[model samples]
Target chain A: NTSELASHELASHELASHDRTTFNPTTEHLTFAARVAWRNAARCVGRGYWPALAVRDLRHISEPQQVFRELQRHLRQAWNGGRIRSTISVFGPGVRILNDQLIRYAGYPDGLGDPQNRRLTAELTALGWSPPVQRSDFDVLPVAIETGGRTQLFEWQADDVQEVAIVHPEVGDLGLRWHALPVISNMELRFAGLTYACAPFNGWYMETEIGARNLADQGRYDRLPELAQRLGLDTARERSLWRDRALVELNRAVLHSFDAAGVRLDDHHSLTRQFVAFEERERAAGRRVNGQWDWLIPPLSPATTPVWARSYREDRELTPGFFHSRRSAF
Target chain B: NTSELASHELASHELASHDRTTFNPTTEHLTFAARVAWRNAARCVGRGYWPALAVRDLRHISEPQQVFRELQRHLRQAWNGGRIRSTISVFGPGVRILNDQLIRYAGYPDGLGDPQNRRLTAELTALGWSPPVQRSDFDVLPVAIETGGRTQLFEWQADDVQEVAIVHPEVGDLGLRWHALPVISNMELRFAGLTYACAPFNGWYMETEIGARNLADQGRYDRLPELAQRLGLDTARERSLWRDRALVELNRAVLHSFDAAGVRLDDHHSLTRQFVAFEERERAAGRRVNGQWDWLIPPLSPATTPVWARSYREDRELTPGFFHSRRSAF
Candidate 1:
């Protein structure tokens, strides 16, 4: 128990660069550390199920092609016929995945698709990755993996990716959709003083992440104005609250569509409640739950959620955790 | 210019408690300090009009009875026939207002009114302040002031307090209403090594303050459930977004009613834009605007505002500002 406590205390601090050479954790230790890392992810509201995370240790495979193949396997396995599984694929040092996420739609030059991915889309285009002859907003980008001073692009076979078409129960179709899996590939997984530069990890999507932010944010999809127009709401006056109505409907669509599609997507309300449960479980286990309150509270009707009323200690030093990478593979 | 720079620099730090005894400021200095304190208030989104703030130097008054009378005068002058004015009355040390605000609705024994004022209402009742013969949700509370180890209650004359009946343009009447003037009475104004224990400040209402929070917050009036029911929204399903729709309608009602009543009320959109202008003006004058982001963004559709995209330094160390008092008067 004392040794476990000491290990946890050590993991709570960022290991200096010199510690990396001396640290050599066993495969079991690596797996447990990875799970603890997921547990330590402060910004994730879906961390209630962190203990059930499947950490695929691909640290032995150093070749880019092998890494790409494993990543493809990861996508298919995690998809699990729409019943999405929480997963992470940890690769060895010097292996980097350029894509911010395993699957992201291309953002075209003319302000089409996800504007957040415009720079990355342009970069992929420069790397000899050809776009489809007919450009669409939903063109999935190729995963660019870098290894041994060389980089290669790998495309996910169409069958590997699953996307849900957003449809409101009351408002009907508005032709909006988002990918099922959200495997974040850019962040480094640091545990036991060792860093995995290519550790792509994911849980199922929270509806608000897609609805209120990704689609509704002005800088992202910028969908509210169009949604408002479609709903025949008055956009002339801010007091009319056309944007607020559109946002709620959009979120409703995301939740309803995901449910109808039988995909494992979490609604903000249910997810926030689970987060509260997660906090209680952590407290019972004698562990402090550090969280960034801004990230914890959903963007939609935030005050309705319990997280809005509570303050959180935003301690980012917790390890066996994911961190921003020092450099991009691109 | 050098002396002015020195004075500005000196005003930026919290003067130690020891300095309070030695501090002696002229009326002109006190007036300027009050305005600057408003400008430096981190949580006030309406502070774009800080320069126009009328500071009444009632600092000479020490009696509780006279303080109560002056506060009533402050309320009426601030009302200005529904075209509210930003005003602050600075009373000298040992003068403390027990009420959190100059005007707030009382919460009865049965949870009919504002629950936030329940404890205060009970305390006032214990001090011999009588409730109305017929209890209502919008009963204006009597002001309690403490001076020289004695507490006294003062009631505002009927015409002095201007209240707007909240009625939606489309949703029509739900029988909700709020007072026009928001005179915060409890906070201590710290400036020039001095603390004004009873400085009550007034600003016009921002519709969201009444609609999205005071009425809609679960701990307050909790109007969303009733409003949602009135609007015939599906309450059983979270995906129906009943609370969100009700919130927007409630906010719309507040804005529409205030406009119809010819009361000065700032909508979130316009106020946030003004806040941006305030930030620009402060920056141009070589001053960093410190703000609490949570307080700055409106609770309703927060991401829709310009303030949502931005981050603010939440420095509480800034002086010539309002601070939470060490102890409550009650």
Candidate 2:
């Protein structure tokens, strides 16, 4: 909650200088900061496309309703009919949202209903947002916006959200779809010693992020076994490496579907090549590229990538970049 | 080289007490030291079977020819017709062998011939050891035993080595074979401040030590692409995860072949379970188990093992343990 600001604290601060009120950055500065933030993202492999980042400056608005409307616009513009563009929308400082992302799958009381949306679904339901139908796995969660000492919910527009249907011969529809834009909403942006608490950013997905980790990790979608079974790989023994085989197919389907839909996503090999180029450019500029080796390496075929062989400096200084805020238990 | 000792320094010590002459350990002490050495092997996952170690004390002999004969005996006893057992042969101190292992594949000048053993083959060939016929992939390397300040080569007997045939339907017999026991020939065994520099040790294989790294690593056999092609995996695309699928199957073949041949080997799952039990036993005995997290976790299906989740103390302490001697460049 924004707490005392809207309740009584604003009265005492009303006589303060206008510098505090004009602390929010202009559109040009916001755009530059967003681009630099992308460049400084140590774990991102797609930083070669940093110059293409689009920034939406919504820092002038303080209302939760208006913030949500801008978020809808950001999603629609970034989605771009599957040709996803890296984008960010900066809501004004002092407003906070507890959720990490603007969209997430919800969990239900029964078995994992919408494997991705469960927690966010509960959070939205607790905030008195009603679903039009029984919750599904692909449900897009409403944004939890806190401003002026109060928290409110804003439902996403159906027209603004675009999902690519995963295509596979044996797997059928499976109803698997990821919201086009992954708007990281809860991270704070620190630039020139000023903190923007509600800056949401987006980038085009790397296929491995969706296929290898999200879909294959046991605690997440856990789709490997199902995919393996559908593909007729022997699942009775671990030696069969059914999981590994299925993981490849799952990743293949993701890349194929995204490419077929014309979404701007990268495969691991191309990303590794781009990262190598990024390293060379950083070296040419007399800057040592700092990165986390584990994060920089792709999940699948890790040994094949050059990033796996090299060491990286763990420089986690927070300035002109994004930093994770204190997470709220959902 | 023994240097001063062979050049008349022994004459001065010859008049000294027999205590200096008989510095070699007794058979019982050798057995105890061998067990402790296996327990201290940081990279080994089969240490739970340390109690069953069979030690061959050949410390009484100092001749290179005699040492080679004993090495043959060690191989046969350790091989034991595919029901392999952990074993070690303690060669007398003051003798240094240049080769790392008693057996290795011969690498030819042509493309990727016997990827694991080429260097040892060259070393032996330089010392006037001739191949009986055209050099094969699974060439049993001759022991280069150094004694009396001189190094000599000793060829292994045909009856001493045993190999399990890998049975994979698609790959057929690619002529891949490994010596029944991995006789680590150059490590020093330090017990109660006593250093035995030429104490060779052997242990049963952990399938991944063969299949995952030795065969699958790019610098080694690198059989994944061949296996993938044979298995009809789509190698044209990285997203297909063909390499990962082939790796799993290769690991499976290793486990299957070892089990079929009645060789005393363990799969990663069983090894992990045994390691967990070993940890518990160590805890119960008031000893904290020292292990390397990276070495303990198997390469194939690493996350599925408990060893991957836990941390280990990096213990480099060297008492009652085996240590690698300075390696001679081949």
Candidate 3:
């Protein structure tokens, strides 16, 4: 989390030339957010601020002058050619306005908590885009785009919120596709029941996928003695099975994240008809004629996504700081 | 520094804190100034932007449009709402703009850097109200504010610039002082020589000062051990002066730092004068009784500060898909 991210790490650091500039997620990013959260907690504790009353009387100040005076000090510093470490709210009593006002003052629209602020994040952690339809520690059901065969998957993890994208060698138009609901704090995640798993071909595989890592990157194929035993029977078949296994594992991960998000893609009538037509075409036209799709596009989650709420206002509030801290393991 | 001040470590830090809060100066307050300086650096590096060259490229797109069109997007999740972290820029060939619109857009500032910014930095830094200003390595000055004989003194130093002040502690009235022309840059620091010197108690004395700790919830006191011993012993009268040589050195250090910060007294009037009347008043005033000060204040530096410019920039311009790695230190 940074200026817009509400990330504490981004706020209170002195990145000198002699100092290192690398991100340690939990230590740096999370710790900073924790600091800000603590600051917020201090304000809450000092003024008896809590979940129920946080929205109303957000201000613990007596009159508007108390807040405005603080704002004036920060503004004066900024105008006096002073540098503001506002990212971490270090200006102290100086920052006493709504997030929108801060952004408006700084030449941007509402950031962080706004439903439409995408510029404040790195990946698709925003609930509106590839929002997580459902999730369990092990499985997730998500509505993602089917650009060819590859897709990006979003997840809400303890350490970071991020999207895991699987880019097939020949698929360049791939991206995650999703259907978003307004907001939901508590929702059940659906599993794909995917026990299917895949393993990638190792260097010793006698036969490997054409688009797979070549000998240049994998080194000589002869180096893996253990895997060479596959040649005795059918090395090509073994390699194929391994690759499929790898895909299966990746698919399961995607599902796990989707299930965690708890918002699934809705039924698209035209898409349903197109799916049938596309299946017929694939069968009649043959999977690969002239550099067409090399693999089958998995069926989109059943048009019947699990029943879930479209929005919830009082239950969960999505903030850039917390979301950025415990982001997905992309 | 253990983030704690020893009862006899140093007292200049407190003076610096006072200066920082009041924006008046005399002696350089090391610890307080250092904290302010570092914070200033953060402000400089992380300063919020002003609406410079403004360009409304065609129409702004929302996260939904981005998902539908496969365009780049930025957004926050339903967690941490205030984090800011997205940057999406498009270049020439990739963008389509109308000729007339392009002309209009040209009026907006294209970049963040502005000449006014640098000049203002130069001024704040000189006043010891900003970062640890240095040029090359030689111009780095250690700032500290000292107090003695009930008078406050501000000290600005380096291999180049030198300035000192003596003033009443309460009303902040200025008195006897000496100054040197200011020159900035690391190269100038090698020549740091200007010093604060005076007569009477100026030779040596122990002093204690207290301020906030790292936790920001506690207070700490630091004492100048060396200053205490020097004033305690009349070494010239003692036959064992040689055996106490170590004490001499420590006392000398204490005296040096102590003298540089001048004095802190409640009255603006002098205790020493040329005639018997002055001597009588001095004896009458003696040393007004006092106790320890336990509160929070920031330090200040003189109006002359050194300059620092980085040697590397282009090497670390994070590009698309390229953000600096956050290290554990961050």
Candidate 4:
């Protein structure tokens, strides 16, 4: 039924030009060694591995259009311009799917990642899922890290400075508008903010996310607050209390989080540290002793001066030593 | 090199007795009613399904201690504890895992569901796999849902209250203490003041993380000043605002969760509808106009105040005709 290039063609590809005997079937255990694999198939066959197995060309099986669309979607997501990655791994195996990238994902029959909803354990067991297993797999999710991937550069020169809005959390809604910061860099990785750049691009383009990370790690942000010491970074002042104000502002954002889980922008990794530090600083600033602790608790504060349920911006700050001890009583 | 009786005995246990001798060596396929199986001995070889798959049976694998300890730890994780159910189908073409519990999940090789992660695509092709190329040869994933697997219930006999501390988002180091309200019904699930439940008795449990969801679905929350109606909930008249006050006082603890995704208290069913409503109330309140905009868009009264960001207090009662479209912009 099919054209044969001669039985020797098959032997030539595998063995030398030796004698050509058709075949015999055999069963043998096989070893596995691959960076990635799909084990779901093994379960159905009722077997594990079969070494010296046959291989087929899977590329032929795919419908071309489907593959193209998928790649497009992945690209849009990887770069936050089009599809913004929102889901954080809070339920089910705690997958950190930033940019929707998968490092290690095995076939999970049902979605167990819902923080609010979960699968019944009994049902899953009947489905052949043996959880509480100690096998973990991972794959490096791709990011615009200059250290690992190559960068593309963009040359879009603007005619004038553009202003963007910064909506403050407490001021109600009016966001302060400021000129876009400049992105001035000669890095090849930045192709008009695609490589490792997010929205606020002025003109400075670095190599990658790792590149930005390296700068921050190398004291870039540390040096930044000092540059604005007079502008707003001055922590020593009380009236314009720059330090407290900045700390307070940062705290406000966190205060604005959903639940105590602190659901804020995942991209803002350094946010937690600042929030924690400000809190520590506040506690360090004791409440001059005779602060109103009784009235500030629940119903007392509700009627007098309203306290937002989601915030820690209370009327007073207790010394850490005092707070640690007195909190239970309060 | 092999023992006759031992091999036959093992094979016999797997197959029917009379069928063993009657099993033709030349037979290429086997049938059980409508269930036709690929008759190749290939299953007898390879990694061996037992080696590649982890079943809780404990007998099929080794180091029972390792398995037990791991399960003990993983069960506490939100993902493992939360999983409701999953089903895996290992087709000849590929492995399919269908998880349909709280959220939906179906994973095959990346190429199956996701186009980008084609690790399975390559591996499958190499394994000479295809989608039913021939009906005679077969495949399938070996997974099924089981009974008596797991169900969590948080049964409380009385309103035995407890306490939990939360770090205020803005307040920093000085922490806030919220009383844990343990009313089994609407009190904790609908209103607030629910830290982790103390279970039926005083039993120790493990943990995991979750998010805010039930708050909205249950309709317990509303926009800011609107949510303030909580103040009106008190039968204790001295303070008409006691309800709102109580919510804030126990805000952290009130919103404390009993997520099914993590290690659950064996005694709690963790009602979904009510559980999600409280979180939603806060979210709904947050969605309302930002508090500062009250000046631009004044609330029902100059004194209504913006409780939208904090607790949902109902103080705004704007007349339907009170649109201020003609007002000058501030």
Top TM-score: which candidate number? 1
lDDT for residue A68 in candidate 1, whole number 0-100:
87
CA displacement after TM-score superposition, residue B245 of candidate 4 (Å): 19
* lDDT per residue as tens, model 2, A1-330: 244224223322432323654554556656766777777888888888877898878778767878878888888888887778888888775688866787766666664644555676777788887765865656666778887777798777778777778776456664577655677887888766567888888887888778777667776777788888888988897656576667767877887788777887788877887888988887876667767665787766565556655777766884567888665444
Evaluate candidate 4 and give its CAPRI docking class based on DockQ.
incorrect
lDDT of 1 at B207: 85
Q: Give the per-residue lDDT digits (tens) of candidate 1, residues A1-330.
A: 466556555544434323677766656566668878888888888888976788898888879889988998999899998899998988877888889999999999898788899988888888879989898878899988888777788888988789989887877887889999999989988865578888999889988889998999999998999999989998998767788889988988898898899999887777898899999989987889979887888888788787888888866878878998768743
DockQ, all models = 0.63, 0.27, 0.00, 0.01
Candidate 1: docking tier = medium
Q: Model 4 over residues B1-330: C-alpha lDDT tens digits?
A: 144235434433444433543443211111110011110111111111111121122112222233223322222322233331111111111111111111111124422222221333333333443433332111121111111332121111122222233332332221222222111110000001111111000111111001011111112121123233433343343223332223232222222322211322211112212222433543564522212221111111111111212322222322110111221110
Predicted structure 4: lDDT = 0.21
Ranking by DockQ: 1, 2, 4, 3
The DockQ score of candidate 3 comes to 0.00
- Scanning candidate 2 chain B in windows of ten residues, the lowest lDDT window is B7-16
Q: What's each prediction's TM-score?
A: 0.93, 0.79, 0.15, 0.18
Worst 10 residues of 1 chain B by lDDT: B9-18
Clashing pairs in 1: A37-A320
* Candidate 3 segments exceeding 4 Å error: A1-330, B2-27, B30-34, B40-330
**lDDT of model 4 at position B252:** 25
